[model samples]
Target: AYEYTLKAEKVCEEGTQKQIPLYDHYFFSILICAEVFKLDSSFHDQAKKIAYKNLKNLKKVQTQMPKNFRSRYLLAKAVIKMNFSPNLKKEISFDFLSVIGVANEDNYLHIEGIACEIYGRFLKDKGIHLDGAHYLKRALGLYERWGANFKVQAIANEISNIQNDDFNKEININSFIEISESLSNERDLEVIFKNILETAITFSNSLKGAIFRRDHNQYFVISNVNNDISHYPQSIIDYAYNSNQIVRIDSIFDLEDFSKDKYFTNNQVRSLLALPLVANGEVESVLYLENSKVDKVFTADKTRILEIISTQMALSIKNAYLFKNLEKLVSERTEELEKKTHQLQISSGEKQTLIRVLCHDLANLLMSSRISFKRLNKKLKELELSDPDITRYLKKIDSSFTNQSHVIDNVRHLELAKEKGFQITLTTVDFLKTLTNSIDTFEQQISTKKINIVINENLNDIEVLSDELCLGVNILNNLISNAIKFTFEGGKISFGLQDDDQEYYYIYIKDSGIGMKDQMVRNMFQDNIHTSTRGTNSEPGSGFGLSIIKSYVNKMNGDISVTSKHKDDFPEESGTTFILKLKKAV
Candidate 1:
């Protein structure tokens, strides 16, 4: 094949041919196909047409073929290229695949390997993966062994591209995730700062490192693995602030050069490098590394690598620093929050105290006024024209007293909720028994309001770990009151119990009450926020009932959320649901 192909190669190379009929042979035609395609691809389709004309010629030469795998393999290669004519891959069959497999599995393992790789690539290109990723794996291994650098690189590039496609579809944690994750443990900023310095110096092969907070005017040796510890240099601490650049020197002589004129040699070392550690755009410190040994010089590569490492070290340390600042911010914010919360707590307590005083005191005052007015009314009636002006003043005084009492009632309700804030007393209480007890307590209110209450019998069986009286009564009272307030005359209020995957036995109290607006839901549990309106029938109570329910629910380490048909665009279906997820008993 070589001898015949070579003569043909020379003939084509010569570019001078007579008797075009003799030149159109299979061997010669293939050489033309290769040459034309190298020059330009359009010629191969032209050459394929010429190659097909000589198939019978290939059949005649099969008798002179060698017993080696080369002939069968080359034949397959020729036909495969031919097969590209008008898309012959679709016309191929099991037998055709077997032939290509044979070309790869035969003694021509070199060519065989390439064929197998190409087959796998064909499958991969068409998204036709076989069992266990067999084809692509085999192709990668075979191509690597074949010493085909370009082909190997191409396959790697494809796999990388596919991996990139997968990466592009993914949703990564944003910068805020890092911010929030840092915020979760923000109090230990100093420890994290020390860790950052220790990690950079130790792993980065620096002899020692330190952190100086410029704002605080304090410096601490964060990490040190110095060889000469007989004397610690204190002048170096002072000198670092004086020299600003990232300092790297080759020898003790170089240090002498910088020390004589550059004004940074006060804390001199034999061969030392220093880089500025920056955080939030300010020079926080100068990080220095020393090689006190006499023989070695820090190479350019070594210094640059150190510089890059320092840059990264600077960034990470800066991040921890920013993290510290954030911690300070959060601390300040949280302290301010606590101060406000405490003030609110105190104010809430005072309001509640005032409510209690108002409750008894104002009730007494109103009664006394009522009595005074009664006596005056009786006396005026007895007198014929009993000071008409005084009569009118009595009526005005009575009206003012009623309004004052109404205001005091609301104040008293807010005070009770503020003082009792979700009274949490954990005990293993029977869920059913406690719930039934709470229901029994509200029987008077239910009867007075003429609202029908329905409790499923199943609520009589479960046990829960909670402050049964405080938690149960608060939930039942708020939900039942809501139900009675919103439900029509004959509407039903129901309570149900169940277990959920969160390991909690739940007591759900849902009501047929008027639903709330979406915007009001967020502020529902926050104190000092007014987020209520009149009920369906204008029955007025301080909106402290639900707020009291929320306070208790939170103290129990449980959660309560309301689901209503509220929308941004439409009025709701006029019902609210209370879903209480409580920690279940063991």
Candidate 2:
């Protein structure tokens, strides 16, 4: 079968076909060859080599295969390793048991049966007759479900042989199963340790028992059953933990120095059994059982059962501690995330409040400065024969004060809109008149930049329902100011208004200047984004114009959008257009 499978593998690999099925055939052939080689001593080395190769290949493709097939491959590899290698018995047993768990989880009945049968046979060969018989019976039941009559009969015959051979000293299979089930279900470390002690006392028929777990260099009694006695003496626990051996005191009176130990004097413990739980070459826990009334209550059979139980308990205790620590870490991280989120919200609120206060105070100071500049300019004009340079200097200072006052007012307007919401008093007004007034306000800046402003003829006499005095003027002023700032010298800026049948007006403001990039256009209207760009003549801007425009447009129940391209990139078609829409008055 191996030779034929190799032939098929070559055909599939060289032919125009899928290689997955060929790989599956190769994997199964290697498994069969390894099993065949295990029967003869001359081929044992070959079997080990084949098994190692199979394990490597299975791992390479395990994730790509189906769950059931992957589990089967793992079980086969573990079984082969167990059979061929005597030194790897402990490691192979863990791998075999892990595969059994996977088989049970994925409901792979055939694989589970195979794993149980192999493990049972292995245990029986190692002189663990009772454990082997228990697993063999379990496998027999599963095989019966699949109508495997030959396998059932074979396992039954093996069970009968074991029973007849050891009828005088029969093992309690039910008690072992019950202890395993109980330990598997328990998740808490303290609870599982207590359960282990309780199960150990019941199995051994001892009066009292206590479990001591080692943490770092310290050993503490974690669980106790039947706690009527006083201290059991830390020296006994330390002796078993440090020695890494079971301390069995069948008869305390037999020892001449028994009175020297404090545990014998303090308690009525006649017989004692302390079993150390060792894992990975380290002592993890110890099980101490005592019988006050009986001298030799713990027998060889009972001690053996306690050893098995202690081994399982050590692993469970370690897993439970790890799970508990993970839960604590997750809880602490969640609390920290919530605290950071709350702090961010508080910081944002404080920043908004500061902007409002600073803008309000700055607006007041600029207003007073403007008043004094106006009075000075009037007195200078009164002296018509005064120096022209003095008059010009005062005019430039006045212009600077006016520009600063406009910027502060815009900031204050934005703060009010954010704080009180965009609440507008809707009144019917001429759209053209409002737009013209907004343009007239920026006349100084427009002349300085030498830009031409054009109002479309169709926008004449248009009426809209808006806060024409304040909100309407502010929205138009922002858009026009931006257009003038960005437009090159002697560039044309056109404005137009159109109304749809749905009673909505569209105001278009197009500029012949440096157009904004795609990213700038995307973030232009966002209040949190600062999209500040220098003008054609290096004129400074506040970056708050678009945010204020968006707020006012939303207040008037309208929307705004822009389309632009950089003037340098496309000299002829390079410009920006601002489209503002509002509700047409009835």
Candidate 3:
């Protein structure tokens, strides 16, 4: 048919009557060839190329033709273009509509029928079965009207094929969805391979199946069901793997030359199928299925379904391999962490014991020294030899002892707070009493600095949820002592209590003193920073006082914050205010 069309086109080009009617025979022949060849996969490509080349040539002289000829020419052009680029729906639709418009105006039934048939096929290819069937029926009616019995019968067959295809597609889609869901969460490679082989066997209605995985050039059995690795046809498997295509044999006799081979000649082995699972453009594995009972079990439809399953199986196998590796890495890391944690526990226990011994021994020695110093002061007073310098030296000695005691106590308390399983016992406590006791503890330092302590009148017998030892000794004592140490001579330290009708009450401790810098305030409560500065009288301190305060406050479920301005930053109003928000006793 293609050769005849070419011969007719050549004659039309050569003769003096190279006009519409002469070219009609060539185009009509070419159109029929395109339509017939498009139904067969073997000739589909050649048909498109031939039709496209001739239509492109016809396009140059198409405008000179009459309406009927131009419309027929357009219908043939659209059909060929659709074969070349089936996905170009918009361009194809516009071309079909243009042909139909001219056909309607000129009453060209044949041209319209052909346009509707091509449009219906395009829609059917895209899975629009209902709409495609509508157009197919329309074309069938138009062909009947134009007295083309063959085209009418062809359109009727197309509609029947669409109905069958739609049903098969629906079943295929549901099966794929179920298979995908079943394999989505499978992480074990052995389990994944087993499931894939079993599913392939069931779906293909095969008696036995095996999945062979490829590593470089080697193929090994990963999973098998009712079959051994040696039982599968190696030649079929090799062909599918090497060619990256599905190989199916309905019967041993179909192998032709290999039909007499031992594997194929066996009476028990009738049908064989080998499918290559390709991932990332590489053949990763091959699935082999055999049906001993049925000769032609692996049909074309079954082969297509198995091919789609092969794609999903490839991804599942890859993911399972990755998950296995990730699980191994996590196990190794967890074991290493456990070893390091054990070593750290031993080291920490040894350190804690050493600290406790030192604190205990040093506290007893300091107590003995204090007793001896008091006895000596008494003896000197009894002798009535009160030299002015002697009194001053004794005072300085006492101050040194006091500073050493404070350092030792701060270290001991900090160690206790950090001890494992240590917990603060919160209970209802008198807030006013705690404040007063803390103030009394720092009375000697306040007197030496001559700082006036102004207790707020609103500080009544208010109760708060707190640990008494943490609140009084660790928190309040450190804050009051700091106020006295930093205040200038005769400076004022004020305490204010506030109730804002909330779940917690606020306590404000403000002092008029040489306040802190921005950097000092920022790092004051951080355990890693050294924020301690010498007092107005050069009194010393352990830098962890605020750190201990913060830790205990957090344990008691309270909050603490500080606001300070250095004397350099604010000359007149330079002081630090520490605010504590403690829960009110219910």
| Index of the highest-lDDT prediction | 3
Predicted candidate 3 versus true structure: per-residue lDDT over 408-496, tens digit per residue: 77566665666653676799999889898678666656877888888888878778899886688778888888888898999999998
RMSD of 1: 27.1
Task: Encode model 1's per-residue lDDT on 440-511: one tens digit a residue.
Answer: 645545665566677777667566667765555556546666666765555557777644665775566666
TM-score of each: 0.30, 0.36, 0.34
Model 3 clashes, total count: 0
Expressed as tens digits, the lDDT of each residue in 1-586 for candidate 2 is: 6456557657866883545675565456666666667666776665567556656666666667657367767786776677666568788778779888888888877778888888888887877665676677678778888788998879767765654443223444334334433443344666767766766664554556788876776556654543322367567777888899887777767445345677667677667888987654677778888766456656666676567556545544544454455445544643553455455533545446645755665565556545534543563355353555555545555655665665666566666677776566899889888887678667667887888988889897778888865544567777887888889889999988644657787878999998988889898887655567788888656465787777777887888889899766787888998887888888
Better of 2 and 3 by lDDT: 3
Clashes of 1: 3
| lDDT, candidate 3, at 254 | 74
How far off is residue 454 in model 1, in Å? 3.1
Model 3: residues with Cα > 4 Å off, grouped in runs: 1-361, 369-416, 499-501
Model 1 misses residue 412 by how many Å?
A: 9.7
Query: Which number leads on TM-score?
Result: 2
Q: Give the Å error, residue 214, model 2.
A: 86
